[model samples]
Target: MANQEKKRGIGFYLLVGVGALFVISIISRDKNTSPTTSTSAASAARPSSAPEPPKAPQIDARVTARELFEAYEKNEIAADNRFKDKLLEVSGKVDNVGKDLLDTPYVALSTGGKFDILGVQAFFDDASLPKLANLSKGQDVTVACRCDGKFGNVMLKECTLK
Candidate 1:
C-alpha cells in the first residue's frame, strides 16, 4: 500500500541519518597525535643550515610619493628606475580642475600653492582616480599612487584621499 511504502521510505532515511551520525561521532574522537621525541631530536641535531627566506621588499624601501613624483618630473634619476610599478602614498588636494582644450578631465594636486598637473592622462579616469565629487577646492588629503616616469611626465594611479 502507499502508506506502507511511505513509512518504509521514511524509516530508510532515518536509518541512514542515524548511521551517518554514528560514523561522524566515531571519526570526531581526537587522536593524540604528536611528533615523536626521537624525530624532533634528530631534526634538532641536523638543523636546517639553509639561509632564511628573504623578507618581502617594502614599497617604501624603494621610494616614497614625493621621490617618485620628483623622479618623473626630473627624469634624470636613472632610466632603469621605472616607478610605474609601485604603489605610492601621497598627500595633496582633491580636485577636478576642468578638462583641457581637447576635453579631458584634469585633476590638480595643490602642495603649498605650488600645484602640479598630475602630468599623465591617467589620473582622470573615473575608475583609477578617486571620485573627489565631495571635495572642495584646497581640501588637503593623501593618496596612493604608482608613477609613470617620463620627462615632465608624472601620473597618479589608485588616487585616494585619506
Candidate 2:
C-alpha cells in the first residue's frame, strides 16, 4: 500500500511538471510568432486580407471564452437563434477531437457553460493542429474562431495551448 501511494504521488508531480513545461513552450512560441507577424506588413495587415488566416485571425483570442459568449448573448435578441454566427475569436478547452474522412482533424472546445455546442463544429487549419493533436481531453486552450450562431457552430481558425 505504501509503495503504491508513493508511486501515485510521484506520478502526480511528474504530470504537473510536464504540463508546466508545455505551457512555457506555448508562451514562448506565441511570443516569438507575434513579433515576426506584426512587424512584417504581410497579408493580415492588408485591407483585402482574407477572412481568417491560420497564423493570424481577424479576432483576438486573448479574450476569455465566457466573455465572447456573453457578448454575443447580449447582442442577439434570442439565445436560441444563430448565436454561433458571431465573428468571435475566443479561447477555451479541447473538449473533443475527431478526424474527418479526408484525414483532417477537428477540435471542439467547451464554452465553459456560456454557450451550447450541440451540433456545431470548430475548424483548425493545418498550421495550428500540430501543437494540439496529441493533447488530452481536458487540456485548456485558446482558439481563434468565427462562431456560426448560438445554434452551436463555430469555425476554428487558430489555436494556442494555454
Give the top-scoring candidate (lDDT). Answer: 2
Candidate 1 per-residue lDDT, tens place, 74-127, comes to 664662266555655556554445555665554555533246654332254454
Give each model a TM-score. Answer: 0.41, 0.41
Poorest lDDT segment (10 consecutive residues) of candidate 2: 153-162
Report the C-alpha lDDT of model 2 over 27-141, residue by residue, as the tens digit: 9999877756555767567668457645643442345556555655566455325434444455667678876577666777666664465433466667656765686776776
- How close to the true structure is residue 27 of candidate 2, measured as C-alpha lDDT? 97
- Which stretches of model 1 miss by more than 4 angstroms? 1-68, 73-75, 79-82, 94-96, 99-106, 111-124, 127-130
Candidate 2, residue 132: how far the Cα is off, in Å: 2.8
lDDT of 1: 0.55
TM-score of 2: 0.41
| Deviation of model 1 at 58, angstroms | 7.6
Number of clashes in model 1?
Answer: 0
Error at 47, model 2, angstroms? 29
For candidate 1, give the lDDT of residue 66. 49
